[model samples]
Target chain A: MALPDQITFASSPALSRNVVDALRAMIASGAVGEGEHLKESELADALGVSRGPIREAFQQLENEGFIELRRHRGAFVTTLRRRDIEEVYSLRIALEQLAMERAATRITPAILARMNEVLDAMQHVSPDAPASEAVALDLDFHDLVYEAADHDRLMRSWRYIRSQVSFFLQVRNRSHPDFVSVGYAEHRQIRDVLVAGDPGRRPTRSSTTSGDALPAPRRSRERPGLIAASGRRDPA
Target chain B: MALPDQITFASSPALSRNVVDALRAMIASGAVGEGEHLKESELADALGVSRGPIREAFQQLENEGFIELRRHRGAFVTTLRRRDIEEVYSLRIALEQLAMERAATRITPAILARMNEVLDAMQHVSPDAPASEAVALDLDFHDLVYEAADHDRLMRSWRYIRSQVSFFLQVRNRSHPDFVSVGYAEHRQIRDVLVAGDPGRRPTRSSTTSGDALPAPRRSRERPGLIAASGRRDPA
Candidate 1:
């Protein structure tokens, strides 16, 4: 059976991988709340697959740190902590900063156009739109940078943490209703920096603007400042 | 049944993850040569597990880029190319360099001692010892850095690319027989720098020394210089 349109899994004949993608999206989008128990039968029913693929996906998800499988108790969504946010952001900053550096040097006119296209799409998103919309466009902008960098393994590493980043962005979207406009300005600054073509000038651009690591829960305001200067803008 | 002692999996009760470790070890160690077909039944028999776990492991391995699942043709180990070496090394340098930087700042005396212990163990290995010996200690040295970084997601990113790095290091071990001793010196330099307590000074230390990456198979000689100053060593 074909995976539904909304499930953006890379096309593969392996039912389990598709199931992994579907379930991962559900978890990342918060359709399945953190710490919520996952029942194989229920997931199977929702995804229109069998328990076999669901079980297989559980193993992969456990390995990916997306969920925890308790012995005999089944799977539970891994709860995000302040540390998880900090860890993800710190690594994302390192990787994305490197990518931006490389992308700045190697970026082509076509890639810039594509990035502008994504930014234009971001311009259309409503401040009160679903978090997924803002999150999707935000990731697309970074994805273009990774693409321009053209380092296969580097992009692979970005993918490893992307879903988690998406989850955080979702939180940022809800927490900051003005994220659409604020995020737009931040992304435009990044694009303008790239267009300026001085990779060496702002080598630590992302991390510098991101402030220190997301040190505590109260400091969650500073978490999604990877590209956005959201830390300076009060959510309240 | 318990996984064998040689299998250093993280003591998970999940049989499939154990199988992933076993199969991953085989491929990374070159026991299952690149492009070799993996028979589920044969692997199941060899590992004394059911075909169920073998099948499940194949899915996970494919996701990890260790093997390719050809529709109806079973699974085959991913063939490493010069591009693979470059891609892996580029990202590894970015991630490991960041790890080393963070580790230098936040590292404890105990972690430094543990790193010293691994270096001492590497010192004892014969220059012509099995590639696996050199690879394990090489990874252990970097693993200590990731552990010292103490960022959960950063370490997770390290593990994501680790097996592939191991595979490349295995290639380095076989291609450069003197890798054991040379690798020891390189690791020692890194340790000394970390011990010097100046993360800010040598921020680009690893990449500056790794050269322009393993650009071609002819340049395979320069591939594993991630830590090793093999670029200047002259393999011939």
Candidate 2:
């Protein structure tokens, strides 16, 4: 049977959303360098869209902490300094701890079942897959934990920080071995703690250092190499 | 001794910082409403600046999550929903817990002395003083606690959430008398707990349904009224 035209159509047109998605991908892909200017005409031309929608997309992106807009100068990608990175990860730890504790009480059987599926997938994926795949799976596992916490605001904040850190994670994953194994073990421990249904489980002060304690990369001038490795043309 | 001209004169003009500050005030002051268009030309005219500086300011603001830019459409003030409020507060709870727990070990004598002063001030504030003054002092007290936690990242995240909630607190404070008193007492208790120097002291699980439970205000059509109450605003 042929479907009605209304049934076949999506509720909203994709132009605005597509622009947002494209811009986000560009930023996330590291095509846009930190503090690089965003020329409206060039971006609009590249995206094959009028300046109006592109401007709107920029506003949305700004709210999401992806880009910075200047009054008259123009927009630019943000630079996350060591201090900024530290602040973000610290917040993440605090929020993750809260989510773990809340999941102890709020995690349902269904949520746990879905989490188990993700864990199984992680275990089964060939280690030969590009490291990015493992990174994505790691993000998915954390996202599931946030979902189980059932706090909408925490989830949004988490998304903001996650986006900011995604590039850093890419660099870190490339440099670190056993990153996946260590992260997976932590996830399993978190899940076990949640399943124990003890909301009182406070995060022990094991190490104040960041995951694996790799020193933060020094600011680099090898823009071309970084851009190529990160798979994005420099927005600058 | 008289200061030298070099010392007295501004060595470096802080145009970018000033612009960021001005734009933040406009947003925080309700001079700009959520979802209202932040036309670059209009803002430039209002701030007595060229489009160049305004563009820079927008970039900074975007990084701070204060405004959203749409392609061609222009930037708009962010409109946070009820769910955003809830998520922010939940994150706040987690961050506060982390800060409080760590503060137990890291609270310096200076910090402790400052806290004692603030608590003493809170106890003796004339009921006749403007509510704004009281609120400002209260915020300062909390800020001190955050500092004592010695985690810059956690404090930064907390600052962002607190700014978002400031608008709501203004309204909440007007109707709730015990809000100030109860909060004062809680602050005292938290201080005492930290003073015990036990980093392992878990936050008591107070009943969630008590009178102290945060009041969930109904969404209203009125513009946020307390935007201008504080001159210091940090977007993130």
Candidate 3:
């Protein structure tokens, strides 16, 4: 699976961030399952690095909530249970709502054009394309909104959950491969609203309080569907 | 200055969290000024630890946005510019608004009583109390609201900016030592609204769209003043 070049640690001084990104990409691509113990020696042998960098990478991953290092035991991949996903979704909704509200007026024409390009990229992904591809594009699309919003701390808050959000998107992509195309239409609606540039009329608030609610069944299918459907400023 | 024992690193399984807490307290208490270079050897010498723990603490501190680790250079304390303060305040206002709205119905009598206790404690804080004392109580007060909200990721998001928020509060306390009393009244108002417990009528939305705006003059005075006064559920 292709990894994002920008997935970096804040403390990049004199450390091998490559190990960090490689492990993150491995986890994000489902190469390693959740709750699996990552042996330092084994990972060092596998990744062709020494134990020191592996340990450092583990520390970085733990910092990013990607892994848990148990005392006396080795590092274990974090399992995002249903409750964790719900927490991530609810928080993401609040953050994106704020981002969209702020971006409504601040969004530049250039950013809108860039968002159109991301949608176009999604359109090019074939049905057999890797789910990670769709996931990356999906994140890229929202990343643009945060960029346009131009609030640094707001962007940081989004990044704080971006990893979990990526996992959630992976679940969604596996559940619905056709979601990419559907997402195209959903994002188009949001883009049109951004193009309209109506801060007062922006549909930042969800009409129903259940906006954060996830359906009991088909967890992946219905959870993001709410945000993709009614959570944004739907001009309709 | 007394530090909160809860300030910890995610990778605390082996490393000494005392170093992280000590450094954070030093930073938050303004013992270490902004943009000041932190020599690892000196810190290790002063804190009576080896350089290894100090390095580990630097990585953790950088992750929490307390300091910046420059490549080829050492660590430096993060300077919260006016822009950074505005960003922190605006994002915080949004997060707290969401927390209070959700906390309205979910807040238990036990929690309200606890909040009342916090306020009572605030009322007793003498004028000459250490600035960090007020800072800790101020954070403790908001920490309860997040707990009442019962959203894990939301609380994590709060913790993300918490250090800067600490710096911001320290700035406020120094500027207005009497803010503890003023804050008592303000929090009492919010507590009354929570006691009212009407989500339908909760004043979650700002009456004026300028809820996030910081008054240009006397930023330390007016920026938090907005959130402390008009940003929450102000029923009156």
Candidate 4:
């Protein structure tokens, strides 16, 4: 009944998918330290599964850039060198800023209310709360932004980078106690900017541009590059 | 010597990586059309390899979002749905803008000159020239920006999306004649911006910031977020 650390993947059809999720959680929670080689034999033994599933799991995560598998050597939990952090955060700012700019124009009042609720929860979070709790709240808040932006590709890319962001933070043991309050303020600013910029503020303007006439030129900034082209227009 | 359609590993040290590269090339070039079913037996037969490497390579490409693997049904080449194009382009705009904004500040003269060489190649590429040639030149120009930005993770993410970008363009058969001239102009504009924005423009201002007081805060825009936190300062 009490099989701690054993991966009991209930109801999931794919064994490898469940294993990947379990292993990713373990890495994210610091259960398995970074730079530690993941031995198939040991993991297979501990999780009470065959080496086949473990190998497949390794392949899956490796593809996602979460782990690096060496030819002769075993898999290593990817440790974030300082550069990885800087690169990931730089991408994050570009994506989240663009998401906010778009979300601001399209976000519904219901979404804003939900975002405010997240901000309230963040404000009350204790200074000493676990970093995972804070990271979850932070990701959830931004997820709402991406969702509101209504860009499928953008959302997919964000989810991939989201795992990497949490991975590095966990490895470096870098989340500090004072960050809760600071993050709260930063998120609050984001929420305010979204509300202030929402075109739904004037519902008629949004309706004019809401329908399917302008599918290709989704963002105003990107239009100049392609629109100016003499060709490349869809006849539709 | 002409083993048409067969994947020859030859002298490559890593089989799976080479297979992944070859297969990715096939997909990107439209040699393997969208929605095509890739069977391990068939692929391994054609490539003159065993099923093992083919399976691993499929997994690798799947991880990169190039193909979809279904249970018992095998892998299917992902068709570039309209939204995928929109998604890739949206992410591209966010990424290129951030890259240009950063590259403008730090790009070196030699790098700008190399990018100029790419622009020259693009300008000469005839409208009848293959889309592949134009796409390669275009990527090279942007690659220079990513390199100048000097962010490894950013570059990695860019390359992943770059494949999908090329994949869709090739599939739709939509790289019109006017695009050659239009793309040439766009790339030139980008090159000009990079040269103008190099922080190295005013050598004295750059030199003052260069000698090691700051380590992590690479961009002028992102400093306010993490730097204000009480802990988590970069030891570098």
| Per-prediction TM-score to the true structure, in the order listed | 0.78, 0.61, 0.78, 0.71
Model 3 pairs in collision: A203-A233
Q: How many clashes show up per model?
A: 0, 39, 1, 4
| Error at B160, model 1, angstroms | 2.0
Q: Who is ahead in TM-score, 3 or 4?
A: 3
- Report the Cα lDDT for residue A181, model 2: 70
Taken in order, the candidates have interface RMSDs of 2.3, 5.2, 2.4, 2.2
lDDT of 2 by residue, A156-199 (tens): 66776776566557766776756767655656666687788874
Tens digits of lDDT, candidate 2, B1-236: 11112212123455656767766766766666667778777666665666766776675566556777555676777776554455655666677777877788889999999998988888887766666556666677778879998875566566766655555555566777666566567667767878887745556534111123345544663344433222222243
What residue pairs clash in candidate 4, if any at all? B7-B47, B104-B197, B104-B198, B105-B199
Off by over 4 Å in 3: A1-15, A71-74, A205-236, B1-15, B200-236
Candidates in order have lDDT scores of 0.71, 0.65, 0.70, 0.65
DockQ winner, 1 or 3: 1
User: TM-score of chain B only, all predictions?
Assistant: 0.74, 0.75, 0.74, 0.73
* Model 3 lDDT tens row, B74-191: 8987765556666777787678767877788789888888998999998888878887787787788788888898887788788877777776676666666676566666677777
Fraction of true contacts retained by every candidate, in order, equals 0.76, 0.72, 0.69, 0.79
What digit string (tens of lDDT, one per residue) describes model 3 on residues A1-236? 22243333455345457788889889876788667789887777666667877877887887667888776787987765556666776677678777877788899889889999998987787878787787788788889989998998898788878887776677666656676666666677677767777634325544211211222234555443323322211113
Per-residue lDDT tens digits of candidate 1, residues B36-125?
778887778777778898888898888777887776788877765555666776677678767877888888999999999999998899
TM-score, chain A only, candidate 1, equals 0.74
DockQ, model 3, C-alpha based: 0.48
Candidate 4 Cα deviation (angstroms), residue B42: 3.3
- Stretches of candidate 2 off by over 4 Å are A1-16, A205-236, B1-89, B99-124, B128-133, B143-156, B163-236
Best by lDDT: 1
